[model samples]
Every structure is written in structure tokens, then in C-alpha cells.
Target: MIVKRPVSKSLARAFFCIVLLSLLSTGVALLTLASSLRDAEAVNIAGSLRMQSYRLGYDLQANDPQLALHRQQYGRTLDSPVFQQLHHRWVPMQVQESYALLHDRWRQMDACLARGDIIWYRQNIASYVAQIDSFVLALQHYAERKMLLVVAICLLGFGAILLLVFFTLRRINQQVVAPLSALVEASRRIEQGRFDHPPLETRLTNELGLLGRTFTRMSGELEKLYRSLEESVAEKTLSLQEANRMLEVLFHCSQALNVGTIDRRCFRHILQLVREHEPVSSVEMAVGATWRLQEGEALADAPWQTLPITMQETRFGELRWQGETADKPSPQLMQSVANMLGRGLYFNQAQKHTQQLLLMEERATIARELHDSLAQVLSYLRIQLTLLRRAVPEENRAAQGIIGDFTRALNDAYQQLRELLTTFRLTLQQADFPAALEEMIEPLRAQTAATIQLDCRLSLLALDAQQQVHLLQIIREAVLNAIKHADAQEISVSCVSAPEGHHAVYIHDDGCGIESVNEPEGHYGLTIMRERAERLGGALTISRQRNGGTLVSVSFTTLSGEQTAGRPDNNNDDND
Candidate 1:
């Protein structure tokens, strides 16, 4: 493995330069001081020459025999290593000259001592001593200069070291301290979830610089990751909200369909819920071939998405939505709604069937009770009146006439009771409103040679059971009135939606119009018809047409549509 060395411009290199400068300065100072160590010793040896000269002069004056020994000692002292160093080339010129002169004087003194020339030796001894003093003074000056040189080297080295240390410290602050501080601050920023701090310093060639660069890159990546995480979280939150909305809509749909009878209003309410929750412009539902419920604007040319409403493999119809293509509902949600609608339809059919059965059973009970009670009583009263009339005498014509009136009234009452029984026993017989109407008219058609036509447009109204019954009774009574009283040759029964949100039933017969508005005695056909119309929350009108016919018309509203009213008893007799 190749390990990278630190660059020369690094903090370590700066410190190394400072240390090297200090070492060089100290070594030079020590070397200069060591070279001047012998200067003081040389001066001491030179000063002793004065003492040796005095000793030799005294020996010559006193004729001492030990003078020769002292002379040898002086020669040895003059040739000492410390004094000989003055003759080398590094010595000052004045010091060298003084040493040469002192050496010459010493040799002359030694010669004079051997020749016994006391006068010459004594006269020149003081001058030779002066020359030795001059050599010592020169050596002392040289030693002082060496000391000053060492001091200068020490000061220069100290100054250079100080300068280098200052620069090195500044470099360390820039390369290490500043970058470290930035990195620490960067760490804090990241901790605080902020990644937009100032740029860090990476220009340096040290470890700190590399760390700064790496940290910068890491922060960039972290910012990207954090942004991505934020985006993901936002998306998840939106998805959760959408899911919650969808669940709420589905829950409401279930609530609406949970009823026993699902009407157009319920289906319309479901469509309204979808419109509120979804981004739809309009919505519509088609049940069977004729029933349709819609909410919002009806745009015929708008593109629509259709979902089949099916349950148990029986498709009730289709649900359609009109809006922007991008605003389509979830297939799963729409399908679920469709399935719920299908189930509701199924339940509605079953409930209607049950209600029809119950209605028929109640009607039969009423008819049976009437037959067992009112009819039997009416028949017995008619027989008793007949026998009493037979028992009455031919005389007393007023009483006889009264008996005849009573007998005729009894017969009319019995016939009316039988008609009531038949009407009470009538049922829908698993037929729709139109079919029931047709069945009621079929018998009347035989009673008249005139063509009896039935025109019905009640599909759009979708009348409930009570509505169907009241409407059927009203139409049947009008048709019977025309057949019995109007003497019409042609009759038409029509049921259709009227303007201003109402349904109207019309029974028109082309026959001689009624001569009087008041019904005769014991006849309540118009009264009963008006009462039924009032029960239906409508107005019934019997008017003579200009073409010599009577028109009986009833106009009313539906509960699910514009208007409605409380229902009357379903067992009301069709007395007409």
C-alpha cells in the first residue's frame, strides 16, 4: 500500500521548519562559544611572562645557580599550547604580530642567559614584558569579539525562530483550527436539519482540508436525501387523505342502500355524494331500461365512464360519470359502489314484492269480512222487505208506495255492497302500474263497443305502492263514470307527467255531457272521486269538452320529486 505523505505546505511542515531553525541557531552559538574557551587561558599564560622576566633578572643580579632552571621553566611556559594558538591563521593581525615579537624577545633572553650578558638581559626584559602584555591585550580583545559573535548568533537565531513560529501558528490556525471550527458548526447545522450553511474551507493541503471537502459532499447528499424523504412523506400523506375520503364516501353509500326501499332519491343521493367527493362535473345512474337518476349538469356530448352495477351476476344497470378524463374515479371504488347499488335494487324488488303480498292479503281480508257481514245483512234485509211488501194489503196506497221505495233502495244497497266487495278484493297481481291499469280497463272495454285506449307515461315518475293504488282507483272511477253515465262511444285513459313537476291522469270519453253537477239521491260517484283526489293531495276536475264528451283529470305530485303528501288508507273502496 502506498501511503500519501503530507505536503510540505502543511501545518506539520511549518512546525518542523521552526524547530530546525531553533536547532541551527543553538548549534552555531554553542560552536562559537566553544572556539573562544581557550582565549582566557592564553591571556593568563601571557601575563605570567612578566613574572618570569622579573625572576630571571633577579637571578642575573644575584648570581643564583638556579637561574638556568628558571630559564628552562620560562621557555616551556612561552611554548605552551594556549600561547601557540595565537600564531595560527584565525588570530587577529595585531595579536599575531605581538606573539611573534614576544617569541623573538624570549629567544634573545635565553641566549643572553647562556652567554651571561646580564646588562643586556636586564635592559630588554621590561620591553619584552610590555610586548607580552600587548599580546595578552590583543588575545583578550579577540575573545571579547568571539563572545559578541556568539551573542549576535543567538539573537539572530532567536529572532528567526520567533518569526517562523509566528508564521507556523498562523498557518495552523488557518489549516487546522478554522476548518475544525467550520466542521463543528456544520455538524450542528446538520443536527438542526438545516443543510444550507456557508461553504467550508477546503483549499488547504492538510487533513482538515480533506475533512472539509468530504463533509461538504456529505452534506450535499444529505440535503438531497432529506428532500426526497420530505417528498415521499408528502405523497404518503396525500394518499392517506385520499384513502380516508374514499372510505367515507363508501360508508355513506352503504348507509343509504341499507334501507328497505331504495328509490330514485336514494340513488340520486349517492350520485350527489360522488360529485361532492370526486372531481366530477356530472354523474348519472341508469337503473333498468327506464329508471334514471342524475345530479349536476346533464351534458349529452361529454365523454363518460360507465361502470356496470351488478350483483349475483344480474346487472341492474350502469353508473356513468362525466368529467375530465384525468379526474376518473378509482375502478375499485366505483365498482364497489355499483355492486352496492345492485344490491339495493335487489332489496328494493324484494321489499316491493313483500309489500304487494301483504297488501293483497289485507285486501282479501277486507273483502272476506265485507262479504260475511255487510253483504249477508243487506241480502237478508232485501228478502224481509220483499216478504213484507207481499204481506201488505192492496189498499193504503201511500204505505204500499213507501214499501216499493224501500224495496228499490234495498236492491241498490245490495248491488253497491257487491261492487264494494269486488273492488276491495282487487290486487296488483304482480303487475306494474300500467299492467294493472290495463287489467282494470279490460273489463270496461267489454262493457263498451267504443275503442278504449290506455296511454301511460308514469315510468319516469316511479310511483310507490300507495301512489299506484290511489291513482289506479281514481282512473278506474273516472272510466266507470264515463261508461255508466257519460254514454261515451270512445274513451281514453292516459297517465303522464304534467308540467310544473306533477303527474296527471286523464280519462276522456266522447259522449253526452252531464246535465247537472249535483249527484242524484243514493249516488256518490263524483263525491267519492273527489274524496280520493283529495287523499292523493290533488284536484280532480270533471268538465264537459266542447266536442260533446266529459274529461276527468287528476293532477298530483310525487314524494320523491317536487311535492308529496301523507298517504290515505290503501283499503278505500272504489265506490264509483
Candidate 2:
């Protein structure tokens, strides 16, 4: 049967020991005191009897001369004076009854002496002396017996005290010390993650057993906490790894799209990139207030047509896409993609404006081909050189020397090419919204092993191409930010129709949340996100979740009836 242990065995054992010892000591003391009292009583009785005998003999002497002479001859006078002094004091009535026969014998002797019966007096005196001697002997015997009883009691008390000490010590060792030692050992085992044995059992029904039960419960809790800690650590490690992979993917995507200006081909390339990186179910694009696809060819109902695209009197087209309805994207992933899209849009637009300013669209076109083909090949070569340099051992002098020279040349060329490309890319216009967002997030999705669900619920057909681009950029930036910063395992991106003919993009993630830094300088992502929203005539809201993760939302009003009526062939894609 399972039984709860006492809480404090040691304390109970100590208390019992103290009580037992006290009782034993008290008993011993009482026994010793009683013995001493009995001894004193015996001594007093013996002395009183001796005094009575002498007093009787002395009183008889006057009344019975012959008896007195006989007493003298028998040597009774030797102790007569001491007895006379004792008899002068009052005797207790309880002892007087035992002395009545002696008193009568003395009177008889006195009477005989008064009658002058000398021979009879002598005979009676001798017999009376014998009786006095016998009484004295009996009192001595009683005193001796009382002394013996006291001694016996003293011995028994000592033995009992010894027994009590032994039992107390034994109980303390068994119930207290032994169990404590076992508990310590068990704790050590548990610390080492070995929870093999049942906790030590305590039979005692006192406090010690209670303590044992408590320890067992504590051990169980500790074990659970340890396991949870391990699991949490493992989970965090996996998340960190996934984040790193996503960053790598983002980096590569940035490198790929960095070479060109915004164009229809770039937009198509962005769609292709998204399709390759993630399992996007549909892609739609709008340009210059027109849908890219024909009316009958449109895939779904466009939702972005009603959203406000003009921000500070500037118009940017919107693009929308949709993914499988069964899957939902995490907020972090959506945020990351959003941020990337915003940057891509800015770059593509700048590239396009540069092309217009130069008035050398054809030259720019040839330059792009050269840059894409040769520059990519050279970049690949540089990457190989970097790997080779790393592979060369430090101790290998010949290989290190060759590798160092090759690496320096490659680094210098790569640096020059990178600078030239950056300048060239700066001249290019930003890609439309759909292109930029798609370009930014594709790499992130490809690099990480995490499953991503992308949902772009905006309608491109009903709105002008510029509004579509704006909405697409907003969604992309929000999604990318979520993926990169929130460290989310899953991201959800959703766009719903808002009141006042506005559209809202909501990005939510299930990951470690962004720190709620009140200052803009503390969080660059939030600052950038806010800036993008403001520039688009939209508001950005970022909030941390209580359970874990971040939620980013952007909402903006679309143009009124005149702008909506301007686009007659608007097609909305419902990619749910």
C-alpha cells in the first residue's frame, strides 16, 4: 500500500529521545529518593526500639530489685543511659501498640520486685531481657531489608535508563539519519538524470515521513522542468538555424535582381522567382493603371481595385497573388518579404527613371545583357576562388602562396565590379510592386527548410496597375520583415477589404516576438516599415503577441469613383 511519509522524522526522534530520557532520569531520581527515605526510616525505627528496651529495663529496676540486679548482671546497663534519653521523648501512637507487651512485662517485673519475691524477680528480669533483645534484633533486620530494597530499586533505575538511551539512539539512526542519507543519494541520481528508482519509503508515521513525501514530489517537478528546458533549448536552436538559412536566401535573391532596371520582364522574372522559391498558386500583375492579363484570361476577382494607391500625390501600381487556401503564411515571413519588396520597388523605380534621363534605352538594354551574362559568370568564378582559398591549408606554403595571389586579384576585381554594378543599378528604376516583393521573398523561402504559406489576397484587375504595385510592395515588405526579424516558424499573410474602400494587409507570425522598443532608433525594421507605410499614405501598426511573435498590419484608402471607373478592363483574381 502506498503511504505518505512523515515530514520530520529527525525532529520527532529527537523529541521522543528527550522525553524518554527525562522520564528515565525522573524515575531514577525518584527511586533514589525513595530509597534514601526508606533507609532513614529504618534507622529511626531501629534506634527507637533500642531506646524502648533500655527505658523498660530502667523503669523495672526500681519496682523489682531482684530483676534490676539480674538486668545488671546481664550487662543491660551498658546501653541504659542512651536508651533513657530516647524514651524521655514522646513516641508515636502507631508505634505504641507494638510496644504495649513490653510495657506490660516491665510492670509485671516491677510488681514482683515490690512483693520482695527476689527469685521470681530475677527469673522474670532474665526473660524480659531476652524479649528486649529479640525486639532489637527484629528492628535491625527490618532496617537491613529496607536498605536492600533501596539498593535493588537503584539498580533497576540505572538499567532502565541505559535501555532508554540505547533505544533512542537506534531509532534516530534508523528513522532519521538513515533515511536522510538515502534521500541525499537519490537527489544526486536525479541530478544526473537517472530517475530509475522509487523514492525511499519511510514507515514512520511522523514528520520524517512527511518530509520524504515532499522530497518525492519535488523530484518529480524538477524532472519535468528539466525535460521542458531541454525541449525549449532544442526548439530555439532549430529556430536560429532556420533564421540563418532564410537570411542566406534573402542575400542571394538580392544579388540576383540587383543587376537590372524595372521592366515587364523583370516583373515576370519576379513572378518566376516566387514560383521557384515558394509554392505560389497564382500570380497577377497590373501596370500603368491596366491589368497585364485580358478580361477573360484573368484568374480571379481582384481585391486591390478599391484600395487607395496615391500617397502624397504619387501613384504606384499594385500587384496581388494568392496561394493555396489550405496553407497560411506566418507573420514574420510576410514581413520579411514585405521589406524586401519595398527596397526592390525603390531600386527598380530608380533604375527606370535613370533610363528615361539618359535617353539610351537601347544602350541600356545591351549593357544589361552583358552585365547579366558575364557579370554572373565572373561572380561564380569569384565564389569558386573563395572556396578554393579556404580549402588551401595554412601549413602548405606553396598552395597558400598561390592561393593568396589569386584571391587578392579576384577580391580586387570583384570589389570594382561590385561598385560599378551598384552605381549602374542605382541608375535603374524600381520594379513595380509585384516584381519587387516577389524578388525579395523568393530567396528567403528557398534558403530555409521551413514551410512557407504565402497568401496575396489583393485584386489587381479592379484597380489600376499602379495601385496593384503599391499594395503588392506593402504586403511583400511586411512578410519579409516578419520572416527575418520575428524568427517565426510560420507566417500568415492576408488582405481583407476595409471600410471606406480601403485595403488592409495583415502579417502575423508564430515566433519569438520583436522587442517592444518604444524608440524608433531601437528597431530599424519597425522604423523602415513605418516609413514605407507613411510614404504610401498608409498607416503601419506593429504589435508583439502575448504568447509569442509579432503582427504587422498596413492599411490605406484607395482612389475614388473616377479612378475606379477609368480602368474598364480591371480583373480581380480570387486566389483563395
Candidate 3:
């Protein structure tokens, strides 16, 4: 059978006991066997001596030279190895005493026989035989005692082995087998997703104890991972729900924006939906005084977060809200709110611009009709009146005076009609300020035959359509006045950036200087140009240049155009 390593210290004790008892039993059994063998040999030698002594005595009793042969045979037997063993004194104590007595008797008998005393020889022979018989009994007794000792030792060794095995098996059951069974059961429970294992506390220095500790550590880690996995699942579920809600917002808000259904109520509904997802003290949106949506009470400068309401490249206005800071879901809602607000404002303004376009289209049609029909008739009447006044004789002063009055009235009516046509005209085809400036300067460049240089330096200039129209008209009138009144060539229309972050447009020409730069009689065009500049949130100045040219300059500030606000699209920081 194979023996496993000792489970603990107790097993070691059992093993050591078995080994010690085995060695002791082996030694004692061997000693008993040696004693028995020695006793048997000693007994055999004593018996042989007794037989040889008897033969020697009988030979001595015989007469003639044949008796010498008997004596030689007795001496030869005594010298033999079996009989010679009794001659030694180092035998067992009992055998040694018996042999000593027998030898004394035999020696006396031999002396008597040599002197031919038959009476003493016969007496010594019997005594030697008695000593030899007593030695045999003593050896027999010693062998029996050794045999008993051997049997006792064998029984003891067997008992010891049985006891050691029993104790070791019992201890193995308690320490190793039982612990391993408990661990196996715990593993089964763990496989079934039950983490509550039995406590495995031990102070033993054995393999089982170490395995128990390691298993305990493993169970703990598994429990942690299980809990963490559950938490992760819950987190992902929340994320999906949030994604779904945002999709819903995108769907509904797109409908509100796509159709021309955007208004204050729709914007407020969007803000309310966003507030349902997050917190907001107030959300205020303004689409250039046309539409405004405000919900909840607003606090002033209390860490307000600003967002842009924009669609593509067009911006409506800024949306501002103030509230407590929010988490992942809240920021996403903020972005949706921004997108909804931007689209709502964008579509609403688009509708307003559409209506304005229709109204302007109607006005253009009326102006074209007047210019094409009424204006022609007026021109023809004025010419006919001129010819008719010439046909009237100068001698009739009254008729001449009447013709002059009629001509002057017709001329006044024509001038008013022409001014009306200019007033009703709107040139808003271009969107950018720089492009509009170029378009306005193109015609003047062709008419004046002047090398008109447009030195615009700013990359971006933010101005609403109305501001651009008024600003363009001012530039146009100023350039026309410069050409007509100044008779200038080599004009430079320089639009440079001014201090305090203002944009200045300067028109300079080397032309004939005017007597007065201010409003003069019949200088109504200058007055209208100055008014147009004022409407652009700027002032105009007309002055004669030092190098003999007129300078008409207008400086103005751009509207709301700055960096991008918080990129709520990604739900970044509110202040971003």
C-alpha cells in the first residue's frame, strides 16, 4: 500500500510510534531466536559428551590392547566440534556450570582408569552423566523462555501497528478528509451562485489549511465581482433609458421645428420637457424681438449658464438658464433644449423673412409700374411743356409766367416721384457685409472711372440685414456725392478696424473740395446720408482731406458675434 504524507503533527507521532515499536520488536525477536539456537547447540554438545564419557569408561573396563582403540575413539569424539563446544567456558551461565561439574568428574574418572582403579572410574562416570542431563534441562528451559519473549514481542508489534494506524486514520478523517469535504461542498455552493461559505479559520501548518485560506480569498473576490457586475448592469440600463429619452426629444422637437408651428408656446413646451429631465431656475430665449419664450423665475448673475440657439450657420440668439449643476443625463437634456430652441427660432424667423419678402416683392412691382408708365408720361409732359413755353411769345408776359409755373409744378411732381422710387427700392440679395460692399462699389467703379480701392481688413463683421442696408446706402450716397460734387478720380474705399473694436469705412477721393461739408441749401442728399449712418449705430463725418480730397467716414460696432458658447452637443461643462 502507498502511504501519504502525514496530515499534521499527530500523524507524525503515530508514524514514529509504529517505527519505534517495529524496530524494538525486531531486535527482541532476533535476540530470542539467537538464544534458542545457542541453547539447542549447547544441549546437543552436552548429550554428546555424556555418551562419549560412558564409552570411555566402558573402554577402560575392557582388557587387552584392543582397549587402547576404545580410548582413542573417546578422545577423538571429545576433540570433535560438537563435543568441543562444551569445553568452552563462555557458554550460558547454567550450561557453563553444568559443563564444569561434568568435566571434573570425567577428569577424575580418566585418572582412576589410567591407574587401573575400576571402582572410582565407574563412580565418576554416573556423576558426569547426571551433570550432562542437568545441563540439557537448563538449556531447554532457556529456549522456552526465549520463545515466550519472541511471541510477546510479535504480539506487541502487531498491536502497536494496529493502534498507530487507527489513530492516524482517525486524525486524517478529522483534519484532512473532513476539511476537504467541507471545501468541496462550498465549491458546489459557489458554482450555484451562492457565496456564503463556511468559515475556514485554522492555525494548522498543513496543506488542507492553506487550501482553505486560498478558497476563502477566492470566494471574497467572487462576491465583489458579482456585486460590481450587477452595478454595471444597472448603470448600462440607465444609460439606455437616457438614450431613448433623448431620441424621443429629438423626434418631437424636429416636428415642432420642421413645420412652421414654432411659437412661444412651442418653445415653452420644449423648455418644460427639458426641465422635467433636469433643473432650471429659468430659461429665456429671444429671437430678435419677434418671438420670446420665458419659463420660471430668473435670477440675476447667479452663475448663469449660456447656450447658443443656432441652426447651421444662422444664429437666432443666446439661451440662458440658471440652476444647480447637473450630472450626465441633465447635460444631454440641456443640449436637446438648445437644439429645439434654435430650430424653433430659426423657422419662425424664416417665416417672418418670407412674409417680408412677399411684401417687398409687391412694393417692387408697384415701383416698376410707376417707373415704366407714370414716370414716362411725366417726362414726356415736361418736354412738351418746355416746347410749348418756347412757342408762347415773350411779349405776352402773362402767358409766359403761366407756362413757367406749370413747368415748375411738373418738375416738382417728377422729383417727388423719383424720390419715392428710391425709397421703396431694397437691395438685399447679398448676405455678407464685405460682399455687399464690393457689389455697391462695383457700379461706382464703372461710373467714376476712378481706381476705387476697397481696403477691408476685418474677416468677420456681424450686422443684421437692416444695419447692412442702411450702412450700404450711406456708402453709396457718400461715394456718389464725392464723384458728382468733388469730380474725383483715384478713390480709395478703406474699411479698417478702429479702436474699441469698431469697424470704420472711409471713402476718400482726390476731387474738387466742397465749400461746406455740413447741410447746405438744396443739399438734401447729404442730410439723408447722415441719417442713414445714424441708423447704423454710427456717426458720419464729411471733411476736406489735407491733400485736396473729401473724406466721408463712418464707424460702427458689430452685433453679437463671439466665440462658440458651451458645446452642449457633447454635454461639456456649463461654462464652456
* C-alpha TM-score for every candidate: 0.71, 0.36, 0.46
Model 2 misplacement above 4 A: 1-137, 152-249, 260-327, 349-576
Tell me how many clashing residue pairs each candidate has: 0, 91, 0
Better of 1 and 2 by TM-score: 1
Which digits, one per residue and each the tens of the lDDT, describe model 2 over residues 245-287?
5565466556556664333334445545544554345644443
- Which candidate gets the maximum lDDT versus the true structure? 1
Tell me which residue pairs clash in candidate 3: none
List RMSD in Å for every model shown: 6.1, 27.9, 13.7
Off by over 4 Å in 3: 1-137, 148-403, 412-430, 518-523, 545-547, 559-576
Q: After superposition, how far is residue 131 of candidate 1 from its true place, in Å?
A: 3.2
| Candidate closer to the true structure by lDDT (higher is better), 2 or 3 | 3
Expressed as tens digits, the lDDT of each residue in 1-576 for candidate 1 is 121434444656777887888899889989888888887788888888889889988898899999999999999998998877776687788888888888898898899988889889868877887788888788889999989988999899999988888877787787677888999999999999999788998776667767788899899999999999999999999989878888999999988776656666677778888888887788888754555777788677888889998878977688998874566777777878888888877676566556666766777888898899988998888888889878888797988999899889888888777767766676765335676678777877888777889998765236666666667777877787788878788889888764333778888889898766677888766777788787677888888888789888998766652233233445444323
Give the per-residue lDDT of model 3 (tens digit) for 262-282: 444466667666556556777
